[model samples]
Structures are given as C-alpha cells and as structure tokens.
Target: MRRVPGRPFEPEEYVLETNTILFRVFSTGGMVPRTVTDFNPGKGDRTRFAFFGDPTVPVLYAAESEEAAVCESILHDVPSGPGAVLYESFADRVCAPLAPTRDLSLVSLMGDGLFKLGTQARYVTGTMASQYTRTVRWAEAVHEAGFDGLVWMSNRRNTDRAFVFFGDRVEAGDLVALPGTGRIFAAGAGFDWLADYLTSLKIEILIP
Candidate 1:
C-alpha cells in the first residue's frame, strides 16, 4: 500500500498478488456492494479490504468493457450478427473476479521426459433458442455457482462450442483429465496463454 516516491497515489488503486498471478483493481464501479461480504472501506467510501488471493472474490467491476460485452452475449447481444455491440449503457456490467486458467503443477505431475498428447476444444455455448434462454436465465447463476467470470471462446457466431458456465473453478488440466471424469478436451479465452506454454513443451494443436 506504499505509494511511489513523489507520485500522487490514486485513491482507486488496488492490487492482488498470489504466487502465480498479479493484477490491478481497475474500479469497483460494477461491484454488487450489497452482495459483497466484509466490505470495509479504508478511506471515504472506498473499500480498503482489497487484495484477495481467492479467485472467488471479484477484483474489479467491468462496466461496458468489451470482455463483458462478449461474455454476456447470451443475454441478447450476439444474434444481431457479427460486430454486434453490447453493454451500450450503464445498465450492463460484468464483475471480473480473478481466476487461474492454467495449472502449472502439470509439469511435475507428468514426470520427467514424459509427454502426452491431448486435444483442447474451444469452449462455446450450445446453439439453440432454448439454450440462449437458459443462458439469459442463468445470468445470476454464475454468482450462485461461484464463478469468477463467464469465459468465452474464439468463435462468436458458433455458439454451439462447449461453454463452461462455472469456469472460475476450472484449472489447466481439467480438460485433459480429472479425478473421475477421465479425459476430455475444452479450451477457453482465459487459457489462451497456455497455447504458447504447451507448445513450448512440444504439444501440438490439431483442428478437425
């Protein structure tokens, strides 16, 4: 919380850091103040209880953000056609909680010199009027399900891609394997960075 020498500290400034991640708190403009637990402002009306290691707590309230517009398309912004704009007004908001997409522990779990090939499918929502309605109804379900954010895939038109509503709980290796689920393949924008990391390990991506 120490301010840099000679630099005026910003009142809205906040930061969270863990062993593997770091990001700044842009603003609480979209925070559900009533829903937030243990909110205590250090100063005038500003919450001082920031810097959370747990991804469940939102770090920023994304208002009219492109990320929000894209992820919340199921709410009614996508079908209008490509380049469809959403969140045009202040009524729309997306809470950006921090979450880990990649689990680096896999490096050790694989053992020395051992390599495995796996497919990673881009996560997308199912295409169906009923599905979109379900999505719209589930707008608040994310908070209920304890997800950081609704992670979207690359394709916007094809909503049929695999979409994980509760993606905040997702880890890097969740797709490749899990305790009881066995092997499966799914990718998300949050894990886009892993593509490069996986390639460094000699893993290849195949499109069918």
Candidate 2:
C-alpha cells in the first residue's frame, strides 16, 4: 500500500480487479463515492461500491459480477487489492454507529455508543511492542490532552515506539466519531482491543 504523506498520511490508490472488471479505491478524507455509477471506471461498465467512515483509513470494495472494459489503466495493478464478494447491502447493524451519544467514556458506553480515549494506550504484546511510533507533535498532543500515558496488554510494559502515526488532531479521551456516518474511527491496536471488550458487553464497534 502506498502512503500519501502530508498532515494526514493516506493510503494511495488501491486497485481491485476481476476477470472482466476493475475498481480503484481511494480514501479522500473518508469521503467515499456514493454509488457504483458515481465513479464507474468507464462510461458503461457495471461497478459497485462501499466504504468506511474514517477519513484517513484505507477502505475496501468488491464486485459480484463484472467484465473487463479494456483500457490502458486496467491492464496494470490487477492483483494488488482485496477481493470482496458483493452484497445487495453491506450494513452492519450490530456494529454501525447509527446514533450519536453524549457519553464519552471509553468503558461506560454501551451497544455502539461513541466515546473518547482517556489516555494514550499502547499494545506492548507480541510483535506489536516494537511497532508503531507516535509522531513528535502527535505525542505532544496526546499528552497535552491529559491522556494517562501508554497502555499495554497482558503484562507487557515496554514503550518502544515505531514510526507509524495515528490521527494528529485527535487527543486522548477525545470522542472518535465520523461525522454524518454515525460511526467512530477506532485506530491503533489498543482501541482495536477496546472494540473487543465492547463486544463482550454486546456492543459492536464500527472501526474504520
């Protein structure tokens, strides 16, 4: 995956292909094309689409049936993207944050409620301990937001940081919500684990 560098490091174009079809997926501030025809590879091709709410996170798409509309672009990068089977609709009622909530506590919210991170948590177990670094400004932002320091899973306490960056403007304990989509952008391994914890409470998280 290519990372476009700037304030927000976004993944470069992800090209998806089928026997007779081609799809290019891009994440522009979380704004995904609304329909298949909205961004058809060509004038009269059958293309379908879907995306997540996170503006910076990379998204995925798949086609049920398609045929290659011969073009110069479709000939390359045909095997790089993920292969997904099309569904009439891919709504995740269990995890979709269809409604917003006032509660911002990471642990107190229930069943798809949005919340903020209370502190800068880290996943220090397995190989994750040595992976993912917080950019200098981002690290400063995490602390300035009054976040409690790093969090680790199990008994791992090592604070080795990698060059991987997280959302910069967002602070610790800040509510992670994707505007207009009724969902939250849960990034990093710690929040990923938090989503699992929420699942234990019968809450499904819409992590983009």
Best by lDDT: 1
Q: Which stretches of candidate 2 lie over 4 Å from their true place?
A: 1-94, 102-131, 135-140, 146-208
Candidate 1, superposed: residue stretches over 4 Å from native: 1-78, 82-97, 101-124, 132-208
| Separate clash counts for every candidate | 3, 9
Compose the digit string of candidate 2's lDDT tens values, residues 11-75.
12111111222222121232343321122222222111111113421211212111111011121
lDDT of 1 by residue, 1-208 (tens): 1111112211111111122221111222444342211122222321111222234332222112333323333223334322322222212322233323343121100112011111111111333433332233222333343443332222332332112222233333332211221111134432353234334434333444
With a 3 Å backbone cut-off (N, CA, C), the pairs that clash in candidate 1 are: 124-161, 124-162, 125-159
Worst 10 residues of 2 by lDDT: 106-115
Model 1: weakest 10-residue lDDT segment is 106-115
Error of 1 at 70 (Å): 2.9
